[model samples]
Target: EAGVAQSPRYKIIEKRQSVAFWCNPISGHATLYWYQQILGQGPKLLIQFQNNGVVDDSQLPKDRFSAERLKGVDSTLKIQPAKLEDSAVYLCASTGTSGVHEQYFGPGTRLTVT
Candidate 1:
């Protein structure tokens, strides 16, 4: 099966600018998740989706970050009016429902704010 796919493996943007990232999860996976990982820290869950409906987004910063999983498949995450601290790795992961719930992750989009 194909692993998760993401574009622009690296990005650089200035503060207060807007940037968007895209993701394509593995086919047949029932659950998908997006996470933000800062340097020297573990990935933090930003949003999670089960099919087309969102299961959790408690950690997402609603003021500047927004995400969606339309058609219960592909997903996109956007950061508008970005801040210096917003620089980090945005990861997209997926898991199949029939087995262990461990997730498979993409190489991630690394954003650097200047």
Candidate 2:
């Protein structure tokens, strides 16, 4: 009974550099989500994946941000030419299939772009 997994729990880079984050959702969980959370603000949904297919990404900044769920399990999020305003916590969460689907969040990757 393990939870979601994310790597490189912290990252720092200069503006204009690129950064990537990884996530592995729980077994059998069909829905996965990536969220961006700025300090003092609630997390904003960046993208969502149901299995290996994308469900939503309208809020994501296409020019600088991208994400994918591979094989319906593992996922990655990348930000290119990072901006100083992109400094925030990137969180990965997953949920089950039941009606009362509870979402589990990973220890976010905090990105600091100088």
Candidate 3:
């Protein structure tokens, strides 16, 4: 099966600018997640989708970050008016949810804001 795919391994941006990232999860997976991982820290959940429906987005910054999974296959995450503190690796993962936390992650999109 095709693994998850992401783009722009790294990105440099200034505060108050906007940026977006893309992700394509594995096939036949039922759950997809987007996480923000700060340097040397564990990945923090930003949003989660169960199939085509959104399961959770509690940690997502509504003021700037937004995402969508219209077809339940590929997803996109966007951050507008970026902040310096937003510098982190954005990882996309997927799991079938047939068992407990069985998730596969993408390489991630790293963002650096100045």
Candidate 4:
């Protein structure tokens, strides 16, 4: 099976600006997730989707960050008025119906806010 696909592997932006990242998960996967990984810490789950419906978003920074899974296939994450603290590698991952233990990740989009 093909791996998850993400766009613009790298991006640099000015603080307070807006940026967006895209992801296309593997076919047949029903669950999708977005995560943020800072320089020294493990990836933090930002949001999760079970087919077009959001399963969890409590960890997401609602004030500046938003995400959606359209048609339960492709997903997008956006940050408006970006902050220096938001600079991190935004990762997209997905898991098959079998379970979360088999999640696959994409080559994350590295965002640098300056």
Clashes of each: 0, 0, 0, 0
TM-score of each: 0.96, 0.96, 0.94, 0.96
Predict model 4's lDDT versus the native: 0.94
Candidate 3 C-alpha lDDT tens digits along 1-114: 888899878999999999999998998888999999999999999999998899999899899999999998889999999999999999999998576687999999999999
Please list the C-alpha lDDT of all candidates, in the order they appear: 0.93, 0.94, 0.93, 0.94
Mind sharing the TM-score for model 1? 0.96
Clashes of 2: 0
Clashing residue pairs in candidate 1 (N, C-alpha, C atoms within 3 angstroms): none
lDDT (0-100) at residue 32 of candidate 2? 95
- How much is the lDDT of residue 38 in candidate 3? 98
Candidate 4 vs. true structure, TM-score: 0.96
lDDT string, candidate 4, 30-93, tens digits = 8999999999999999999989999999999899999988788999999998999999999999
In candidate 1 the C-alpha lDDT for residue 29 amounts to: 86
lDDT of 2 by residue, 22-62 (tens): 99888889899999999999999999999989999999999
The residue-level lDDT of candidate 2 at 20 comes to 98
lDDT at residue 48 of model 2 (Cα atoms): 94
